[model samples]
Target: MADYLPRAPWTQRDDLHRMVDALGNAPDGTSLARWVGGAVRDGLLGEDAADVDCATPLKPQDVMARLKRAGIRTVPTGIDHGTVTALLPGGKVEITTLRRDVSTDGRRATVEYASEWRDDAARRDFTINALYADPRTLEIYDYFGGLADLAVRRVRFIGDARQRIREDHLRILRYYRFQARFGSALDSEAEEACAELAAMLKGLSRERVAMELLNLLGLPDPSDTLLRMEQRGVLGVVLPEVQRPAIEALPTLIGAERQAGLAPQAIRRMAALLPLSPQVAEGVAARLRLSRAQRDRLACVAGRQADDAANPLALAYRCGTECAQDRLLLCGGDPAPLSDWEIPQLPLKGGEIVQRGIKAGPEVARILRAVEARWISEGFPDRERVLRLLEAELPA
Candidate 1:
């Protein structure tokens, strides 16, 4: 495996080199650590990976002691889970001792640290994620058929898919998320397992579910995966409020997004994938425990009506370019001219309304709204024309 595996970019960094040099051998004469999980998986796929996690056979305390003795900083990020974070100069790497699941209640797992790498790999969710790379030798250790799976871009769960889902229901969603990024086809066994356990998703926290769902939605085009989720009844359990019509609109909306050169936005994509009425959006926000910003964005995009986006300038004035363009995409209309549309501020100031002998209370606001509507309706006429329109709307 070492002969075929290319050295990942992170392996060349000085910090990783020193970390490897410092912990090459453990106290019990076991090999110290091997780069594992996403870092190894992505490197083999020829993608630049940010997180570099490692697996070690040493106990947590011994792992800490070795790093400390070698003058490396250590953080007990998940000590009870046999995990330690080694902070290096250029970056940080998470190193966890081998562990086997002792018990699981769907949402949480209890584990006992073990020295066997196979036990660690067995506990992982997917075959690709179980691949390990020796930092010292650049050799990939594939206890499972991870190398074969990666070669064909398959995203299958390790062991019995149903049993894995029973341990952590979140893997149900994770199955789709990983597929959205790396897989070409869904495994029938994994799909059946996920479908059977779809209802169990509610046991997971709203925040965790939201984060994973949003990650899935953030892919360049998640239409196919989303459709599969819908077919398997997963979407009905997760978001019953979403209708088939909204899900059907995704391909066109995604096509519009690509044509307009717009980046994938999770919230906007979410909006495109559901009925964006206030009540439904509110339900989504509450169910997902969305943040204030996320709630507001969803609400704002949901509040838009079809007529509001009919005109480019009016859309720009009311919703801003991004929001209006998203609406246009949702409507299956071209939004290329949006770039040429500029949002113009109301030419008349509040003081001007007051100066016109109008009381400075709600009357002033009323007159400004009236005048701005006239300005928008008239295609944002010049300031003088706007003033004349304002003159007629105010007290004679």
Candidate 2:
């Protein structure tokens, strides 16, 4: 396992080495730090682990002071929760002191720092996430059978599933997200607990829920997990007002998206999970805090009609190649038009209509639009040819 550490991206850099070395030594000159969580899990799986988080025995202030003394930049990103971020040349490394839950209310937790590594491991939600590795010696630490669970492709909670969900309701979505990534069979206990607590997801902020849902949608093949979520009634809890037809279309849409070489997008997938309507897209965007661009794209994608976007010239001219390709993919039609469609600029302008002796009013606008339409129908004629066609419509 130690040999695997150096091969991971986090441990191969010198600056990270120096930062880890500095955080390892406490004020008393005793070494008490180890890399924990995803970095360790991904390293053992032979995946690229870039983000590094470490567990230390030092308290938040002590960790900050030690890094400050070493001339390293530090930020108290989650100081009350016993975590600080050190800015290194390679990237930011989050260092968290060992902690046990003092109290939890399903939405948040009050944490008390702990000195024991086992206690720290126990508080984490999942077994695979609690595994730790010593940075210097490269020793794997598994206090909760995480290595075994990882080997079998199981995603089980560290302790009782219900208790973990009670600590943070977001774990409900996380269960599915992790299942989409690393799970082969559902842990019956975890699945039951999630089904029971699916309603508690309402207490979580929409932004947080949106983030998790987006992440789950990003997986290479989330069709199985989504199908399970639908069957389990968990998908309805998050999107109560969604259209059933859209949900029914997901499996086919996902297959088409993959075949069309399109990367999974949350809004695009979410749009598929609702009735194809601009009104519904706007409502979902408002609820999820999606940015303006995301909201606009969702509206456009949902409003698209397959037959209308089938023509390469019209589709590319109006919606661009990307939108046209996405629409074709959603409608389960040929997407070849997007590869060859080239939009032509309109040859006539309002000023040019005014130059043609048309009055500077709504009539000038109308004339220009008429000429432009004719030009489009004529396969986009040149400026001179368009002006010649406009002669009849000019002032007469």
Candidate 3:
């Protein structure tokens, strides 16, 4: 299948050609670099790849020194793992020496450089990720039936599914994410291995877990994959806070987001997967090690309730535009009101209320609060309406 494979259009770029040329050739006169991993995988799928990584037989220092000779900047992003970052005119390309895993823990691998491309391919997590392409000929090299699996839209582990997951627990999450992004159905063998190794996820850093979950949630529709995770007892392991109610709530939230034309958001989805208790939400967000703003958003979504009968404008005004939208969507209310409309501030000021017969004291604050509530409840009408509200509250 690889032989019949034609060139990837993106490989024809001048910048990419320059990067390959800078890597030079081996003593055998063969090209030292080939485009590896996601770039090749996505190119075959006819979608643009976000990253274009390189594989070479040269050592890490050699990769760096050669790029340095060509006046190309390089960073030893993962030097120990034989990886370097090449800054090109178009974008950053990762250049790593061909390597085989010398040893493996659930977290990381110690690698030794290998001269053969197939040996390097053996260490990768998935079959689809192991494909490579020549920078010059643009011919794809599929070592482990990657093109076959990809043709069928199947995400398969390279060798043994359990062995692969044991090498890195993160691949468990990655399996689900890739399945959601590319596959029509989960690979049963891969799913079974992931389920068996689910407990290993607790060993991974919360930040890593959070990142993968968020990436999954950021997809167009991750509800099915998440449900599968819950069914397999994986979601409960990672996020014990997620209950059946949350499991049921996510599809509704996703539907509301689509109906309201709001983009899928990770934090909001995370909020939906927890009970509507601010304290529980706060604990979950903290456990995920989410950023301060994200934590606050989750807590707000949980803490505040959205009233479907309440005016959308007033909700957006009172709870803030973003939080209100999240709350509304979560609590079965309409979130579409703020889609085009900006939240407006209260039109009347305390000074205006005081200028009416109300004295400059706490009385002024009380009257303003009543008038502002009226203003907001009345769909935040113009100052003309606010003036009448202030008049009615004045000294009576």
* lDDT winner, 1 or 2: 1
Displacement of the residue 97 alpha carbon in candidate 3, Å: 2.0
**RMSD in angstroms, all models?**
2.6, 2.8, 2.4
Clashes of 1: 0
Clashing residue pair totals per candidate (backbone < 3 A): 0, 0, 0
lDDT per residue for candidate 3 within 258-344, as digits (tens), equals: 988899998889888888798998898888899999988998888766454277777777667888888888777887667789877
lDDT of 2 at 215: 91
**Residues 35-72 of candidate 1: C-alpha lDDT, one tens digit per residue:** 89998898888888879998888788987887898899
lDDT of each: 0.84, 0.81, 0.85
Off by over 4 Å in 3: 4-9, 304-306, 351-361
| Model 2 Cα lDDT, one tens digit per residue, 1-396 | 423354665666788778777766656664578889999988888898868898998888988887888888999999878889999888898999999989999888888889889999999999999988877667788988888898888999988999899899999999999999999867999999998888899899999998998899878777778767877878888877665566667778778877877777777787777777889888988888888987887777778785854565666567766666667778777776567557788866788777767779999878878877777667676888987888977755
Rank the candidate models, highest lDDT first: 3, 1, 2
After superposing candidate 1, which stretches have Cα over 4 Å from the reference?
1-4, 26-31, 334-347, 377-389
TM-score, predicted candidate 2 vs. hidden true structure? 0.90
- Please, what is the TM-score per model? 0.90, 0.90, 0.91
